[model samples]
Target: MKKGFKYVFMTLLVVALMLGSFLLGNKMAITTGDKVILNKSDFNIYSKTNQMKAVIDKYFLFDVDERKLEDGVYKGLFKGLNDPYSEYLTKEEFDSFKQSTSGEYKGIGIFITVTEDNLIQVVSPIKDSPAFKAGIKPDDIIYSVNGKVYPGDKLNEATAIMKGKDGDEVKLVIKRKNSTGAYDSIDMDLKVEKIKLLTVESKVIDDLGYLHISQFGEHTYKEFTENYEELKSQNVKGIIIDLRNNPGGLKDSCVKIADYLLPEGPIVKTVDKNKKEEVDMSDAKEENIPMVVLINGGSASASEILSGAIKDYKKATIVGENSYGKGIVQTIAPAKSFGIDDNGAIKLTVQEYFTPKDNKIHEIGVKPDIEVKLPDDIINFGPDFIDTDTQLQKAIEILK
Candidate 1:
């Protein structure tokens, strides 16, 4: 891969790694996005670390593992950014991250994000996957993994524990909201399996097409196009796009799908720290049918891109609550370019994205045209839950 690699619109969760040589700390010159350059001599701050290392080497009670210490320095480097989305990936984590974009992996099959308070929140479980079948729902909190508590900062470590050989059981302690607005702890022993990515799940609800997009993976565009075409062939007159609890994924996948539904215009725009701007546009061709997009707190990044575009152009009526409001973008740059490659890469926050109308999505989410919250009675998104789905019923009411 080249220096500036893929522009990903998703959060690839991970942290912690074994240490290696600190070739990067001493003589290497590193460049920052904001035109800051750090060379060896300018890095006298390392003297403090060295002083601590000397003290630990002399008086520490137990043997110090240089491997883990080195890894800590690497992680600490990125953690200095204070941006939760930006992280340094180890070789193993990087490999797994690549596999996740490909839409398949050996894990319990759930998308997750770490909160500001260092809690791990489940965005959604992949439909039909182990976690999905186990009834793990959105907004669920993961307290511990395999009896070990991993703070939000150690998300990568927790995920590492979750993924493994098929049929291997891993225990997860979850905190779920219950009746009377209380939280309940639940223990689950989930089996690791090879989860095949099926991002788009579609079926006809009378004359309307209901398509729930879990995430925008690499194959998402192709799958979305094929599924929409199938719905068209079946004479479905309207559409309901479900993005609830959908953790966003690839930018390109979302762009292509946006192009299919929208008329010629800018889908989304991004500007980096250098004030450099790039706008993704759609063609004149468009789908003319009535459309309703469903979004909630979990609908983020590229999902906001599509829904924002649809809202900007009045292409679709938005339903449900406000979105997750993650307007910033991240990229996986080749670590080799920085002379720090051990088959690993760095995911850095490169740019802040805007909706087509130039509205910022960073901390403020997109508002729905008609707001309808999910009813308290509706729990799982099972077949029987649709009638009680107030947001969905509102969408149906709009189309009718």
Candidate 2:
């Protein structure tokens, strides 16, 4: 009887050990197998991270959810990443990210900034967006959506709350302070629609033709160049290019427009994180046509590049307020891991751009030759801060 009992006990012990080994192997594979490699040396310490992760899992308050851990690991990995343009987006958030890339979404079409005071203030609304349609003006601070305060949240979250299925309604509670008085808690409901930006707005204001290039969209250069050709064919003597509230897009598109406008040598130069500088060359095309470019505080990135280049080359008259001072350039690189993280999209600020004169415009924005602020008559109507557009008028006058 004693011998039989020993055999059964030994067999049970052996089975238990085998099961434990299998569980441990499975755990290790789930947690540590899917690793990402970053180009930098700092990310090389991931092997040692396995021991640390095991400790964290043991001491963690709640059950260690592997999925959440995977996300945290990926996000933590990017903690050492220096670029602000590069970030990890959650699955749902990534799906809702508002990039001008695919170019189709809806909401009260306004770009807003989260202020230090926990206020969501409008930077500017796209021309004829739902925000413009619902009378949500610029400088209006959004306090809540559907009565839920969302301060300190991601801008994408606030934007998501405001966007929905077409014909759906979104309520926004806003706060605005100006010369009139303190108007707080103003509420507005805007209907969501399929929003497509019409980047180019052209018209003939007397002898000169006016073209407003809002952004460098996918087909911006095609539209811009074709319009210029039409203007030249129409015998328009002067041209005014309005880049007010224009945030730049594709670098090539900006260069294309610059090439058309200037008898170009160097359009812009880029210095990467490695401090390597590359000069972008341009072919002269729109050299002799008298031109004026209008800019404002909202003009940034590629917009600044184009305006700065034109001004440096004496190719066009720069009009209006100083441009928004973003001089960094970004390139999107693939994500390393295909499993936990979707291929990583890296937007490294590889270089700081310089104009033809080798002028650097990092924090200090472009200064227009003619400085003008918007008039109050336009400001009082809604939340919009109307820049007098006297500069645009001046350009038109010069062209005429």
Candidate 3:
């Protein structure tokens, strides 16, 4: 009877162990049953994605490239965020972008953008580049490339057509407004060249330091500080920061430059979705020199950050039209970092940054203390082209 009791006890223990394992598996939704139960919220969250995969696998006619399909799905997912600044970069595009950040590339070396009027406008031609040599001016509307007419919104497509192996020639048909107020077509034959991007251009104009930052890049702060130090050594009375047609770049670079220029204080603040605030502060010990910043509609992102900080701190007089007003901060990460095998990356808008004075300039851009509009005749003239820069004149006047 004792042996029988022992056998019954051992059998009950085995049954209990099995019950525990089953319960644990069920809790984790890991049971290999035909239909594993899931929490209602979790089911709702994943059901649409599962359904989309099922529909695509079943109804798609072509033998789809699984990789391309996956990329499309990811791109679509980000597009659903309804944020223009958020985007998924394909492997090739991401690699190209990485190359650009290094401040070197094989291209025509002109920054182009789609305007609000559905025109492909040249933001600016890199100084001493093939485009600049070929006389591709800012605000020039690109009508066609090599006889191919691309829609204005297809800025990337147009850019690709313009970029080719070094020494290759691309023909651009551009329309510029003539003195009579009518657009005149001009043909430009430009040869692609290896472009080494330079972000900072400096000169001393009548004892005032004139610094033109084309765009903030990875090496911008180093270039800026070197020029700034040289200007200070020259005993400059004041400074002018020209940020016209600057599409902006790395925020760290901008903040560092601001720190070097401004007195010790907060530079900018960023707030995430959870309302967690992160402030970037300046540690400069010297008093800020009298200065003026030049801005225009093309000034954006990092440009806004630097100019806004200066404006908020009363460090400089801001001159020109309203800026582009891109206040959202983007964080880029590789797909592998997020547990995906795709050799691509996502640039997601993770936070919104505010000026030092807690001013948020997202859709509404930072206003200038002194507003100066570019004249129609001189709009195409480069930012530092100097001859017809009324905005620069205004800045110089302010500094003086």
Candidate 4:
């Protein structure tokens, strides 16, 4: 009887263990099995919490809550990424980002970046804005915002705190590198204001037509065309196309600007990972004007493409610090995949861009023919400030 009882207990235990394994496996299959890739050999995504999530939702909670699951999963996933750039922006935050890029967002002007140490730092301040007038400088490490301590290694929380209704005050505790101590809490009253984008600014300085292209916004082509016509009307001796701090936008604008500058030849070519090619639009019949391009580290993407093409074609003299080296072109993919989020949005580096002369402008930046550093004291000018504009000055000297 004792032996029979022991045997029965062992059998029951074995049956219970098998049932538990089946339930766990089935839960994972229902929740996260869909994320598994078929062809990829090296990439694998494993989530043990999905099984726990399934158990809680089905047996314990009995109420479906996607918000809880989404937040839980997102926090879990992003924390592991360890890349400040790699983050999960809620729909609202994502909308804000899109609006900011589209020149539709309202806020006191400031550009920001996350340093390697996970501290948010000011990259630059827009001139005539609250931040600029308040004396915020680049490389100022933000310690706290609005009396709230920074959340554990999360920038999203800090961003949410910084943004609010117009007329709201954001208190910032900042630490400057060369300073002896951190700044006492300073209040920056953010005024909600629409960004008025001016793509082109032209003036004749000493018989030389200076056209500054601030950005490649939506109406860039129209502005550039009108400015070019106006400059021609002025009969300027020469042109200095200033593209400093132009982080580039619409490819069409760059091409249009190149069309106005280049006499002919391919402006740029894009080579895909598969080695396929597409030549960027350019014009050969345009007049080869006596022009100089001014670029710096802030000039990137389309700017790099245009400058590289002009230099390779020997169409214009590139004068400034090295141009930002961004050779990869990203393409939006259609159809949904497991790793991708909504909007069916996937931005994979589809190709590498090359100059008409087949020169690669990847990690290696475009070297200037005449290099001149902008003055550090010129910080007072902010984004609109161009004190000495050493590169522009050099361009003028060359034109003379």
Candidate 5:
């Protein structure tokens, strides 16, 4: 009876040891396996990311660039929002964007955007720029750069390809519509140089002042004031403010310029997502010059803002085709605040702007007082191709 009792005790002790070992093995597996199995109650937002990282670390066959992986994740996060105006900028891209806003850079000096058809279209070439000298025109489609086809998705990527150090040469193959409306490919050789943004161009024509504002950049107001003063000194009868193909810039600059042109009233108003309104008003001092503002399909953002205000105030007669309707205000912020490092940033659409009369021109652009379409043949010509520029002629006649 004593031997039988000892046998049972030994058997029970062995069973307990085996059970303890099994539990320990499972604990180690839960902590060290390629994925962690979490209880439903303990699962959190970050749990899936951790699980994915573990799985990739253990099972991905090829080496991965961790930095690129992180960038992809950041880019994917914004892309998932499905907003085209909102984007993730890399460190390099952010630096380039800053340079652009400062009104200086090394590039071909052209503004571009992706079209609804996914074609890369040149909004306009900066006045007296390498691209302008090369006869690059508005609505020109960029097919390839340096023999490599550029996907028309990121404007910054296309700008980067066109930019290089001084004396560097870049080749572009552009596809433009011919007189028959069929696309024709034209190869261009352009040399990169230090591009100083020239935002304002003015001339006196037949006792009238012609002022073309290519963009509303940092120096635009100062330039606009100087130009206006010079035109006023010339005792011009009227002035034409050309904003055609002007992909807009600084709102403050546009507002200040509008202040010089508008009477004592509200210039523009903006509303945030929280339904808060902020209004910008103009002082009593006004230019009061019989004026006309030119616009086209490429006039956007601040350009639209300026035109809308002028239209509301009857400050100028707007001419040309319908403007590009981009009434959203974009605010830039550092990516680090969103858990991204390496000096990256994002430009997000934060507010919607309206005209002083409370007209919203977001997707629907401001209609011109006189709608005139450029001749198809003249549309593809260089910036100086004014002989066939009927829109400018119409403005000249209006001012005359």
Candidate 6:
């Protein structure tokens, strides 16, 4: 789900697009972490591939594009790993991925994520956007785009399919689950248009400051800092950081905000395949303000980084259910770097990141110091519905 701003986990959670070209067959150089490793593989995969290709070239009756054939093999490299996060992207999909971090783009404004069952599900529709006006709601499964079914693993393709000329219409088939657990299929046609991302929203309730980070984007740190100044101007006593339903975005943005909040200490650490560790530390003087971080199943990757760091330093009280627990990092490189063309790209799982306390948060999420659970039906609430947000009320109570 990514290709921009260092390490991105959510792939923008948007309809933004990034385009590039792809080429193939140079198997020597591979990008790992920040380095390109050049060495012959211990396995004779090239030989096996050539053998299979020879048969296809000699015996297959139907004509096949040799480039596409090789591209399929290249894609199989990542797919064979069987890791859900790592993937191969065509030029169109890669372009869509790069556009995700820009904070604005053209599309049918909708935020989507992968369900636990690996189905593409909508998180929410952007206010006043085509999807929103069409009555699309949170938790609705995106069954198909343009009449073609796209599974969770192929979400990048689905997102790419949503992009087109301004005013272009995109057909959507959604599967919405009803109260009785029965799913009702609905079809809607929405037009693609330019939309800006609002990553952070803030509020002041008497002495308490409330900051809701929908997701980390390229400009989120700037937005957060601006809001923090406003909260300070209001003479806020404490701050509540809400990371519920935040899938996560740019790692650099997350690190910047964490650095802004914490003191001269390690914010997070990353371990590469060789077990080499790098620590990201903050240089700012510590702020002694009281803090409570709120997280739920949707809090992941970069979200986990910020919450875990705050908790590690004992700088905040963590509340709500366990986070989404994505501790690994993924990096994408243009396929041409490995000697491929047609704007092809490869996103591979490069490293695992740990909290400041050296705690692992991959499958095991960051646990709350004080755990609270919201009813399933009420998990998604707007700012206007503060009374129904028990986790937020609990945070406010702690701050008070």
Global fold similarity of model 5 (TM-score): 0.81
For 1-400, candidate 5 gives per-residue lDDT tens digits of 1243335445544543453321333342122244443323223323454457668778999987776666665676666565666777888888887788788899998888766666788877887788888888777999988888886565556678689789888999999988788999999999999998878988888798888888988899999999989999999999989898788988999999989888999999999999999999999999877999999987888999999999999989999999988899988777887675457898788899999999999989899999988886463422355678888888888888
Ranking, TM-score, top scorer first:
1, 5, 3, 6, 2, 4
lDDT of 1 by residue, 285-380 (tens): 999989999998778888999898999999999999999888989998658867964556789999999989999998898999998887664555
Residue-wise lDDT of candidate 6 within 1-400, one digit each (tens)?
0123112212321211232212225544333445543223522465456557668778999988765665677677876787767878878767777786777788897778665577998765655568867877666899999999988877776887786768888999999888799999999999998877788889887688888887888889999999988998898999888887677788999999999999889999999999999899999676677999998876888999999999998999999989877898888889888785447788888999999989999989899999987765563454566788788888888988
How much lDDT does each candidate structure score? Answer: 0.82, 0.69, 0.79, 0.64, 0.81, 0.79
Off by over 4 Å in 2: 1-84, 90-99, 112-123, 134-143, 151-153, 174-186, 336-344, 377-389
Which of 1 and 4 is the better model by TM-score? 1
Candidate 5 stretches greater than 4 Å from native: 1-62, 116-119, 177-184, 336-342, 379-384
Clashing residue pairs, backbone N/CA/C < 3 A, model 1: 14-156, 15-156, 19-67
Among all candidates shown, the one with the greatest TM-score: 1
Among residues 3 or more apart in sequence or in different chains, the pairs in candidate 5 whose N, CA or C atoms overlap within 3 Å are none
Scored by lDDT, model 4 comes in at 0.64
Q: What TM-score, to 2 decimals, does candidate 3 have?
A: 0.78
User: With candidate 6 superimposed using the best TM-score fit, by how many Å does residue 360's alpha carbon deviate from the native?
Assistant: 1.3
Residue 173, candidate 4: C-alpha displacement in angstroms: 4.8
TM-score of 1: 0.86
Per-residue accuracy of model 2 over 1-400 as CA lDDT, tens digit each: 1243335445544543453321332232212234422222222254345556657766878776666566566655654464434456565545544344446666667766545554577755677777876666556788888778877334556877777678888888887676778775677888888778767767766567778887777778888877877887788788888887776767888988888777849999998868888988887555587888888876878899999999998888888789877788876544544343354444445678988898888778899988876664453211122235566657766766
What is the Cα-based lDDT of residue 53 in candidate 4?
54
In model 1, the runs with Cα more than 4 Å from the true position are 1-42, 177-182, 382-384
